[model samples]
Target: MRFIFSVLFFALMTFSLSAQGFNNGVSGEKTFTFFDKAGRNQATFFSTTPLEDINGTANGIDGTVSFDVTNIAKTIKGHVKVEVNSMQTGIDLRDSHLKSPNWLDAETHPEIRFELTGMKDVKSEADNKISGTATGNFTLHGVTKEISVPVTFIYLKESEDTKKRAPGDLLGVNSKFNVKLSDYGVQNDIIGNKVAENIEVTFNVVGTVK
Candidate 1:
């Protein structure tokens, strides 16, 4: 009985401390708008296979986030989108091929998007930051799949230094996740040799409170 009570007490303490660094006594829902500030917001995709490694970056990343610092795990929601045609693989010909009908069909699908529905396993880190798994519906090539992305969020209060970048408070977000091409109905010759079946994606962006 004593052991069980001790375990329960530890769990409760952990849950209480999870929000330690996230709150600055300000508690409310803040709507944040994400914008492209000279390509400050970006998403990159990488694929590696035995034959070759391919990587690409998309500079056209924009989105909005509705977040509440006090109730982060329950009240965080947002959507991020990357323009399909903006993806560049460093090679013009390969970039063209990647957007062609046989590949991503950029004409039919003009954007890749992720809609954040909720968060899980949230824990506060140092420097007013928090880490968690962001649960969202990821849309790619006209297909939508539920994916969980491990993400870190840093909240910065408004200040003179931040005004140089934008207005209001700033939120920095960094996320990394892997997706299977076949799961999204992307099947091609490049999957086996030139590109890996699974592609790794990284997203980094900052948002200004609205």
Candidate 2:
């Protein structure tokens, strides 16, 4: 009994010291900006597009993020989930129409997702950033297509005087991710088949290893 207890106690202590404790991760609320009125007047048009706050889970945005200080190139693979129903363009009538069977078909396709496919090391005049491409299957209007989004990863480390664990060798993904409505068989409206093609999407993600 004594030997068993001693061995178990040592193992637990080693795990507690070497393993990372409950990590208080960072989260962000993203905004969607659109060039309105024929790409002339650009404005943020979202009714409630903020992410539901990433949690520590396999499927969560922050969950799959792995970080490495010496070799960030080795740290690859992350996940993110976007709620389709949460899209808002600041117009109740338009939002409702979008929810219909025309644009997104929210009832059928509820999520827009991305999976990392490649990574590259990049140096800035001031900071370190990682640029890469992500391949994702976006299902819209009952149609799913394989699409690639240009992405950039920028990492910001914490200052020494800070209180909590800072994000070091932070990964920054810069991408020019875009898609079209008609390409996915979705129309602007039930009557108008003309969809403002070329939807430009961008993301700046920072992930920390727990």
Candidate 3:
């Protein structure tokens, strides 16, 4: 009877362990640094107006995220930032103009950042991903505004493929949101109808944790 009880307990433990997925049963708060393989992280912006539409990409993306694997919806926190001077609009002249004081003023405000505050309306998805609305403070051109963005996060356990990108477990974040240039003290009218007042921004970044 004693032997049978021990076998039953062992089986239960194995079952519990197998039930854990992406995070590999890791719990509590884990910090994922975006600095590793940051070049692959991408951020883009699109502006549309009646006269013309323009789009640009910024390659300078890095940040850190701290969150509990067990309670991501409630405990996720971090900040993602993009270098203002790294923006490229295909046209070299326009790119230079964008970094000038009349534009983003990259010399003074080198980075545009989003600091996560809280999350809500979370839903679990397949492949160890979660979708939710994240409320955060977005700072651009030295001005900060409160905004809510729909974000999706995916966790990948360390493996051979993941090691190719980084050294540890990976956290993937994807989000797209709209921002009004005027809200951030950006003058959208200087370019005439070429630049829209509202711009759509999208980013996909992966951070890693050991």
Q: Write the per-residue lDDT of candidate 2 for residues 158-180, one digit (tens) a residue.
A: 55632143333233344555567
Taking the tens digit of each residue's C-alpha lDDT, what string does model 1 give over 1-210?
999999999999756755633766556788888876787788999987677678889989889998777778888889999998999989898888888887899999989999999999888886478898999999998899998989998899989999899888899999988989888887655523457778899988898898
Per model, state how many residue pairs clash.
Answer: 0, 13, 0
Against the hidden reference, what TM-scores do the models get?
A: 0.87, 0.54, 0.84
lDDT of 3 by residue, 59-133 (tens): 898888887776776677888899998899898988888999988999999999999988877766754777789
Model 2: lDDT of residue 11: 99
When 2 and 3 are scored with TM-score, the better candidate is 3
Higher lDDT: candidate 1 or 3?
1
- Residue 60 local lDDT, model 2: 17
- Could you tell me the lDDT of residue 191 within candidate 1? 29
- The candidate 1 region of ten consecutive residues with least summed lDDT is 187-196
lDDT of each: 0.85, 0.44, 0.82
